[model samples]
Structures are given as C-alpha cells and as structure tokens.
Target: MASDYYITADNVFEYSRGNSLFDGLNEDQIKTLFSISREITLGKGSYLMHEGDPAREIFLIIEGELEISRYNAKHNQNHVIATLKAGDTVGEVALLDRGSRSASACAVSFCRLRSVSFDDLQDIADKDKSIYSIFYHMSRNIGERLRHSNDVALQAMEKQLDEFKTRVTLGNFFVYIVIMLSLFTFSLDGLKYIMTAGKNSSYITLPLTLAFFVFFIFFIKTSNFPLSTFGLTLANWKKAVREGIVFTIPFAAVIVAVKWVLISSVPHYMGRPLIEGLTAMNADPKTWWMFLVIYILVIAPLQELLSRGGLQGPLEEFLSSKYKVPLAILVSNLLFSTLHLFMSLEIGLLVFIPGVYFGWLYSRTHNLLGVWIAHALVGTVGLSIVGF
Candidate 1:
C-alpha cells in the first residue's frame, strides 16, 4: 500500500532528469536510485554545504532549486556560481576526492533532496562496474562546472577589485583634505588663545584643546572603516551584567599586581603621594566595597552594552572574519580609554591596558563574564593595597 502511495514513479523520474548526471537514467534507474538514497528536506535559504567544509556526501536535488557560491578573496565577496535545478547532483567530485568544498550550496527554495554517502556509493561502484563508470562521469562533470564557475568568478572579482581600489583612493583624498582643514582651524584657535590669554590660561585651556585634538584623531582613524557596529541591546542587559562580573575579577587582580609593582618602584614625589593615597584606599574595606560596586554595577555592564551589544552584530556581518575580532577589541579599548581622559595620564594608560584586555576577552567569548571577572579582581586587589 505504501508502494502504491500517491508518490508516483513518473514523478521520481521527472525529478531525476532535472539533474545532468541522471539525465540518461531511465524510470527503473531513478527508482533504484531512490531505493538506495535517503530523502532530506530543507527550508529555503538553508545551506547544504559551507565553503571550505569537508565534502562528505553528494546531494541529488529531487525538487526545487539550489544556489552554489564560492568565496572570492579579491572582491571580498561570496560570488554566486550556479543555480541548480531539481535532479542535479552536487559535491560529487569533492566527496569522491575527500577534499574541502570549493563552493557552498544553499537551498534557493524549499528543497527535497536524496543524499548518498561516499561509502554507500563506493559500495555500489565496487559491486557494479557500470555504476562506477556513471559515478566517475558525474564526478568529472561536477568538477568541470566548478572550474568554470571559479574562472568566471575570478574575472568578475578582478574588475570589482579595481573599482574598489579607485573608490578607496578617491575617498582617502577627501579625508586628507578634511584633516588638513581641521589642523588649520586648531592652529588658528591655539594662536588666538595664546595671544589673548596668559601662561596660566594655556594650562586652563589644555584639556579642552586636547579634547578637540583627540576627537579629530578618532574621526580620522575611523574614516576608512570596515565593519564596526554595536549589537548589544537593552534585551541583552542581563547577559552583559553576567559577562561584566566574570571579566572584572581577573582584570582587577592584574591591575592590583601592576599597581603594587609601580608603588614599590616609583620614587616618592608629588605624583607618588597621590598614587600611594589611591593604593592605600584600595586596602580599606569601604573602598573595596565601593570599587566592587562601581566596577560590577556601573562600568562593566555599561561598557559591554556600548561596545558589544546593539549595532555591532550588523557591522560584524559585513566584516571579513579575520579582521572582526581585532577591530572590535580596538574600538572598545579606545572608547574605554577616552572615558578616563580626565584622570591622570598614567592612571588612564593603566586602565586602558586592562580595558583592551577586557575587550579582547569579550570579543573572544562573545560573553561578558571573563572580562567582568578580570576587571573586578584587578580593581579590588589594586585598590586594597593602595589604601583605597
């Protein structure tokens, strides 16, 4: 009764012809193929194989269409190489050779596929010489198609790469012009301030003047940007808090050790007294509590939310995998350091290093815990010794 089910032989054969390899197979052969194969269904836009993944099995599309794409390094794009309709067999060559997949395959529509593992096919080929011939031919055909696709992709990428280079050159020219204008404005303002105000006025103006310089520097640095977005949102606040605590602990420990070393090594001077006072405050139980509260409740959650939470997800989608982690950490570290600019340069730099470390941890874990523990530990230890 199941054999006499609504799924007919004519339907199977018609589907088989959609694939080039099965083009020559008769209804009996299609039925035999179906007997040996397992059916799989995929939703539209689902991946069958990812680029660089080991090809383990060949897929025969029984219904719908599949899209094949290869990563093109020159254009930094995933180039669509082919559209495969029903009955097409893909990954035969890579499966047979046990090689990395040169192209990725995704379902263009809801797809029904029959998959035959390399081992199963090999067993069949070993038993029947004719089957081996068919298998060999199918593998060769898939290889040829893949080669042709690569060639076309390369040619298209070359053109795109040239266009991209030209655009970058033009963009940089405009950026340089902007930087020049900013420098001119700053120079004029500095001259006017100096002429109108006394030496003490220069000290009073120093912070504001430096702020402008830093703003311009940041603008310039980020002008020719790759992907940099923050994805953390208010919904992720709970997760960020968890991450922040994990990050602060170890980070605080390291900070404590570093501060202790500095206190032991640095000679007593005006700056030393201040540093000593800060270190002493850390030893106080009240100071420890305050430091813990500030780091865990205030700084960790806020910083992670800003750097890793919201728009960062979309920005990361556009970036090359290799550049993503570094960029995230760098941007986060810079923001952290900028927030501490009002503090002493030495203290700011000290905090900046730990901030960078924390950022790296956040990027690597995609969780806030590691960085939070590091931060809290370092802060608690450092402040305790300094008599905070």
Candidate 2:
C-alpha cells in the first residue's frame, strides 16, 4: 500500500538529510532549514506551473515525477525538455528574478512536493541575516545541477557520435572518390564542369553546386548514416570555433610562408584573378566581388561539405577503427590535395598544407562549422595576398 501520510519537519529533515539541498548540513541544520517549508500533494497531469504564470514559489520534489515542457512555435506543440523527480528543485530562478515562468510543468505522477514560497523565504530573511547563507546554499545546489546536466549532455553527444561513426561504410568513401574523379576527368578542369558549357558563366555554378549537394544526400543514403553525422550543432558550435582557431594557427603560418615564397615567382600558383574567369566569366572588374561572394557563400560550403563532411568523415570512421586517426587524416589530406593536381605542384602544395590541417581538425572534432570557418579564413587570406 502507498504511504500518503502528511510530512513533518522531522520526516522532511530525515528524507532530505543527504539530499543536495541539505548536503554538508548536520541533522540539526537540516531540520532547521526544512522546518520553514510545508508539503502539498499534486494530482497526476495537473499543472504545477504554466508558462507565463507569475513566479511566487519554488518546489522541491518529495515524491513522483514532473514533466517540464516548453511550447515550440515552429511545431505548434509542446516539447518536453526534461523531467524532474524526487530531490529535484524548480522555480528557484523565478524567486531571484521575480519573472514569469519560461516553461510549463505538470505532474507526471501523483507528486508530493515541499513548497517554499517567496513570502516564506522573505520572512526568514527578514528575521536573520544568516538567511543569506540559505540563498548561497540554494545557488550552490542549482550550480551543481547545471554542471551535472552539462556532463550528461556531453556524454549523450559522445554516444550519438559513436553511433554515427558505426554507421559509416567503406562504400560511401569509394563512391565519392570514383564519382569525383569521373567529374574531374570529364571536365579537364573543375571550372568547366561548373560552367554551363556556353558563352557566359552567369552563376551556372549554382546548378552544378546543387548536383554536388545531391551527391551528399546519396552519400548519406549509401553510408546508412543520419544527416546529423555532419556539421556543428548549437550545443557544440562554441567548442568548434575555439578548436578551429587553435588548430588553424600553426597551419596558417606555414601557408603564409610557403605562398610568400612562390607567389611572385609562379604566376599560376598565385592571384585571385586565377578563379575570376571561371567565377565571373571574365565579367567587369567591378562584378568580381559579386562572383567572389557566390564562391565564398555557396562554393566554399559545398566543397567542404563534399570533401570534409562526405569523404573525410566516413573515411575517418572506417580507417580510424583499424589504422586509427593519423592514417585517416593523412589520406583525407592526400585526396583533398590531389584534386588540385590539375593546376601545378606549387599550387597543389599550397592547398595541401591547409587540407592536411582541415582534415586533421575535422578528424578530431567532426564539426563542420569549424571546418567552414577555417576554410573561409584560409581562402580569404589567400585571395587577399594574391590580389584581384
């Protein structure tokens, strides 16, 4: 039979003695702390708090579960973000801000909650200056919970990444290589393939870009990997940007030194003007910037998506399991650099060093945001140094 007796200070102190709220407190301290609180029972499916409701109280779950949800405007529905159980606390932020609730919460099961109102807290604070210590204790409890939540989120990400790594197949890597080689061979230069095979380039690269995009979708299907396998997520984008900057620094130094030596000597190896014919179709000098924008916004993303996200990703997965990370990084660099072989050895080397840097970075992080940022930085720097 379920025991549904009314709780006393003695029981509250007993039950929560080792709980986070009472953590580091003695029995007397726990009893004194919990003595101010009262208990209430909420029925299953009843709202404990509604989004936009005025915040006046916080609750510590004594028994059962509460489902916390937020309304998503995009979906036109409520998405449950979390569930709170015994020993969990909610609405503490409200007591601090006196702001409205940001989410809806309802009991998932018949719940017993230790209710501590803002008014009650104020009374305790007014009586004794030592009540400031309670606020400190509350902040510590919330801070610890946030830290624990962050740890759990990171672990989940690793688990998801592992699942994606497992889904990668050797076939995906081979197909991308063969398809890309065929396209490169047929075009003689990748530029013509991007052109409309007509008098003007007129952003014809857009449709060719779309075709390359189709190849990525095909890669996902063939590899049996989810689309989530690629790209930096909101959860990890900050880390991606930091890692991208740190990894690219040393590589950028070498790139600058190498290009500085060859740029004046080799006409073919240097100059943003090299791509002007393909990008702008030899349009007016003023129109060069417009075409450059297209190249950066459209072409760079697609190219990285293809080589880094599509090719390097699965190759890393397949090879890393056997030969491990270094071999996978080397092959990805070699393949990326090989694509530039149509130009010249000097040009190829210039591209190769950055390719190696990018390949290694993505191998370690699997974050496409970082890869794209690195690509943009390196490409922009190259264009600037080589002139229009």
Candidate 3:
C-alpha cells in the first residue's frame, strides 16, 4: 500500500541522507533513483521477504526498523541475525547474483520502505555511468554483513554452550518456585498481618514494598547480575510505554465489554459496584487519595518487581527450552495467580490474565517503568473503577 502513500523525492532523500548507499549522488541522479524505486508500507510483524524466496529487488529503509532473521533447523527457531533501520539496504546480494534470499526481513514496527530492482539500476546506468557507484557500495555492504554474520554465529555458539552448562535442574526449579511462593505469602499476608495486627491493610504495602526493594538490591549485588537483568533501568522507557499502551488498549476494551455483559446479565452481579465504591470513597476525599496513591506507588511496582523481576527474569536466563521466554512468563504467572488465591478464586484467576500481559510486556520492553505504568492503569481501571 506504500504505492498509494504520497512521498516526494525530497522526502526520501532527506530521510536517507545519512545512509552510505546514497553517498555521492547528485540531485538529478537522486531524483532518478527515487523515480525508479517503488515505495512500500509494512505493518508491524509483517514479512517483507522470506529466506529462500527468489529475490527480484533490493529494499531501502525510509523509516522504522526491520528484523533480519534466518531459520535454524537445529533449534527449530528463527534466529534474528540483524536489525536494519533508516538509510539501510537489504537484498543487495540478490542483485549481485540473482540468488535466493539468505534471510527473512520482517517489520518490527509500522514501516515505510523503498525498493529497486536490478533492471531499474540498468536503466539508470544506461543514461548515466554514475549509477555503478551504487553497485560498488552494495559490494562493500555485502562484505560488511558477511563479517558481521561470522561474529553473530560465533556469539550464538557461545550462548548455546553457556546455556547448556547453566541450565537449571528440575529440583532447582522446584526449590525456586517454593521460595518465591513463600516470599510472596510472607510479604503480603504474614508480615502485613503482624505489622498491622489484621486491622489496617491500606498502609501496609508501602513498608513491605520498601523492604523488598532493599532486599532486591542486596540480592542483585550478591548474585552478580546487572540491574537490566531485572528490567530495573529506564532504557527504552518511551518505546516501552508506547508499545505497552498499544498492546493494552484493545485488551482493556475487551475486559470492559465483558464486565458490562456480566453486570447486565447476572443477578446481584458482583457486590460493591465500582460506582458505589467510588461514591463512598468520594464522600471521604482522604480515602480516595489514599487508594490511588497506594495502588499506583506501592502495589503496582511491588507486584511487577516480584512477579517479573524476581521470578520471570531468573527463569528466562536458566531455562533451556526452545520456547524458554514464553515458558518463563507462563510459569511465573502461574505462581503470580497462586499467590492471589488467598484473596478469592475469582480474584486469583483474574490476576493471571493481567499477569500474563505484564510478563509479555516486560519481555518485550525489558523495562519496569513501562510495565508498572501499564499495571497501574489496568489495575486502577479494572479493580477500582470497573470493580472487576
């Protein structure tokens, strides 16, 4: 659909000015190049080209990112070999030899692309000899990629060896699971009940949260893992938040719709409706402010740190399964839901749905801030506002 998208030569040139492929072209030649190329639009996760496909053209990135990956038959997985961004070129090797593609190109986000075929280059070369300069650049790009590929292959081998050596044993996994569940109960129920004498659950989260925060820092220091291992850093906060919001909105809408159906269809549906709770809290302004502040500041981040950082982070590193990351997320969320069973079965099940979302979001973003924001929004809206 990029053919329908309006784009001028000037726009393409400006966007790709930093790219080495267009290094020395004059204004007219650049215009000719743009005229010969076809624009393309790709939705996130859509493939532009697949490995072993006959290559008819080379592509240029105008905007957004592309993941260059190859399927590994041994692992039965598509291993990402490279990431291409604006001003980068793909499929140059195809132009050189007219061979099948070595790797697949998939969009990481919504993308704007421009592609040119070997025939198009020949047309320009006939008119002007300078077109061959692009070919020269393409050769250099191929050589660079080949070198990079060798390095990546070496790294992959090293990673496989490391995983083989460090893979967690079944007994070790059970120990970890037990330890995590014990810690969750101790923090949420045992310590809270003791400190508050079972009278005040509102102000208890802050102290427990602070204690766990200190414990995590100490544990990280002793364990010799980077803060990033737990998604504690603020790196990629903007993109993380953006992606989290995009992922959460549609799911949130579905949840709201389900809640509406339940309230309308079921008799005496879910005692203490959100509206009545809000009205009662509104009658006491202090209570409303306390609820918001506690959930947002203390509860949301605490839960993320425990479920994602404490449990899922370690599981991802130690698990040796082909689908380790997804397995880690699922296993961690099972424990996440289990910890909430003390509240009620319905609450336990409901938390698992959101727990999985939070886990997946953390996996993609690798930042606690974004996941925390998403958790805060969803919990406040779903539990406090919608009374789900």
Count of clashes, each model: 61, 0, 0
- Global lDDT of each model? 0.59, 0.69, 0.77
Give the winner by TM-score: 3
Quote the lDDT for 305 in model 3: 86
lDDT of 2 by residue, 40-151 (tens): 7888888999999999888888788999888988979986767888888888878777899988989998888888888887886686656666677788876876786678
Question: Which lDDT value does model 2 have at 299?
Answer: 71
TM-scores, all models, native as reference: 0.39, 0.46, 0.51
The segments of candidate 1 whose C-alpha lies over 4 angstroms from its true place after superposition are 1-11, 14-19, 23-27, 51-54, 70-81, 100-103, 168-388
RMSD of each: 14.3, 17.4, 14.0
- Tell me the lDDT of model 2 at 106: 95
- C-alpha root-mean-square deviation, candidate 2: 17.4
Worst 10 residues of 3 by lDDT: 165-174
Q: What is the lDDT of residue 168 in candidate 1?
A: 68
- Models sorted by TM-score, best on top: 3, 2, 1
lDDT for each residue of candidate 3 in 314-362, tens digit (9 for 90 to 100): 7887777999999999998997787556656887799899899899899
Error of 2 at 193 (Å): 10
